[model samples]
Target: MKKYSYQKCTAIVLAFIMFFSLFAGVNQAKAEAGLNVNADGAILVDGETGKVLYEKNADSPLGIASMTKMMSEYLLLDAVKHGKVKWNQEYSVSELVYKISQPTSLSNVPLRRDGKYNVRELYEAMAIYSANGATIALAEVIAGSETNFVKMMNEKAKKLGLKNTKFVNSTGLNNKDYHGEQPQGTGADEENVMSPRDVATLAFHLINEYPDVLKTASTPMKVFREGTTDRIVMKNWNWMLPSLVYGYKGMDGLKTGTTDFAGYCFTGTATRDGKRFITVVQNAKDSSGKNDGYKARFGETKKMLDYAFSNYTKEELVAKHYQVKGHKTIPVIKGKEDKVKIYTKSAINMVIPNNEKDNYKPVLVLDKKKVNKNGEVTAPIKKGEKLGYLTIEPKNGDKVSFLTEEGQKKVQVDIIAVQDVEKANWFVLMMRSIGNFFGDVGHGISSTVKGWF
Candidate 1:
């Protein structure tokens, strides 16, 4: 009887352990299935604020195919803006550009040495169709040669604060096959590489600096060199536009790329009810067994977009001239007034996930400290002088993090003085000294009494 009782207890304990293990497995599977993305790297960002909403291996440097053309496009437009080039200016096709236009290539607009194209035509082909040859032509026009153009690309990447990005060619092609004049200081082994985070940064700059690029990028199809019988019809390759299955309502201009080494990649932007978001996916599955030519890249993009739009909302967390609650009244000594009111230096707003918004808490961190010798804040403070910063975070028990405009994890803004405070007169100084003397005496008595307790 004793042996049977012991055996029954052992069986019960083993059954409980097995049940819990199965339950835990099911929950883990559910969580993974909800966010199962096939992309090697991905990121979703709030467009205006540059806040990263979601990311997976975003900072890992990887080959970015034709997405390199976005930077190339930026330089072209910037040159035009700076009067270095004109929109109608025509450029001759170089031997290298013609080679890039070979029919056997992945995608090309078929450039001919005999054909002279304007800057506008080249820019359109490069952006809308991901035309490699057209991109090389434009690069040559701007920097005199692709080698010099690549130097400019790297320089701009540095200016943009991209830590893990390097460009070997203006066109996003792999560098191993290039037999032409090599990029200065680069052995033909280098290929254009950028992290998904850097790619989103590049896109945000493109849209913010030159919003006009979107006008051309949003076009579904347009005829190049119209009215000519040999004019080529170019179609936009981005599938997230309104006409496709994964299409969202406000989807618009961006870029896409695919290569054997790079797999498939895309950077996309969309707006809904005045809120905009940017998303980037890199090195996604090249085939979903659908044989439709488009890989899992587009599907992964849709998943990210849907999650962002469905879960988040644009909120005005704080406003310009908005007085911070606890930090508004700052003690001031030797000043005309006893205290100075403070206000935010600028407006503060962000896209917060709807579920986390209720738990959101705004905190103001000031640089000033109260010194017993001087009493609170020293006077002669100028209005609009930067005192400190305001930061926003979620309340306790919340797992989500917010992002600042600079893409940092914490959202922070400047805290400025609302009014100027001049030094106090002699009479006012004497009154403050008397009050402080008595206040110290009373504090000593209270401390002595507490010690007795």
Candidate 2:
């Protein structure tokens, strides 16, 4: 009987352990399947604030294919803005451009050998159809040569704070595709490369700086040089557009890229109900790795968008005029008031996960340069004077990041003085100084007496 009882107890314990193991395995599987974006690198961010919503290996540099045109588009728009280039400016194709445009296998709108195309038409072809010849043509016109334009691209990348970006050519094609006519400084087999994070940063600046580019990017199709013999119908490769096969609602202007080296890549943006999101998927493939193509890249982007819209919403975590505890007021020296009240200059709103609302907390950071040893500001404080900063952090210690490296730190708002504080009158200052001197002497005398006792 005793042996049987012991055996039964052992069996019960084994069954309990087995049940928990199965339960844990099921939960782990669910977590892994949450957002299974099959790609070499991917990222999603809020278009307005550049806050990173999700990321997967987003810092690794990889082939970007035709997305390199985004940088070209930026420079072109900047030139037009600054009066350096004009839409009606004409470009005469060089011998190298003519040869590159003649390849039937490449994505090109065949150019007439003796024809002159204006900036507007070539821009449409490059932005809408990813035409390599048109891109190189613009690069030449803007910088006098493709080689010089590449230098400008890298220079602008640094200016925009793109950390992991490099431009080998304006067209984002492999140098080998140039057929020995590659840009002067690039290698024969080099391809333009950028990390997903850098790509998203570039897109963020592009959309914010030149929103009109979306007008061309969102077009479903257009005829090159309409009403002319050389005309060809150029359809946009971004299938996620509302007029395309996938026809994702709120989907619009962005870029798509594909090559044997880059596999498939896309930088997509969409707006819905006053909210916009930007997503990038690099070298996208399926779990089986057999469906690495145009569809795969779009599919992965949809997954990220769906997850973002479903789980996150904009919340005003801190209200304007908010005063941090233990930092509500700052001492004022030689002023009419002994201290001045301080509050946040503006409210801080962030798109955060629904379940993590209570996890955030406020942190105050005072500017040491403006304050004295006692944390006091001198007289003559102006209303709304910025004195410090208020930054937000998650109490749960969750990692929060942004699309740009500079935004990696937490979001912050300015802390300013609530009202003006002028210098005290001379009579008041004299009386205060006399009182302080006497108080110090009395304290010293008291200390000496205590020591003698």
Instruction: Give the best candidate by lDDT.
Output: 2
- lDDT score for candidate 2 against the true structure: 0.90
lDDT of 1 at 357: 57
Question: What's the distance in Å from true for residue 90, model 2?
Answer: 1.8
lDDT of 1 by residue, 286-326 (tens): 43533123547777778878888887888877787778766
Where does model 1 exceed 4 Å of error?
A: 1-33, 102-104, 176-190, 244-246, 286-295, 319-325, 345-347, 368-375, 381-385, 397-405, 408-410, 430-453
Error of 1 at 397 (Å): 7.6
Q: How accurate is candidate 1 locally (lDDT)?
A: 0.81
> All models: lDDT?
0.81, 0.90
Instruction: Single out the weakest 10-residue window by summed lDDT for candidate 2.
Output: 402-411
Encode model 2's per-residue lDDT on 312-350: one tens digit a residue: 887888899999989899999999999999999998877
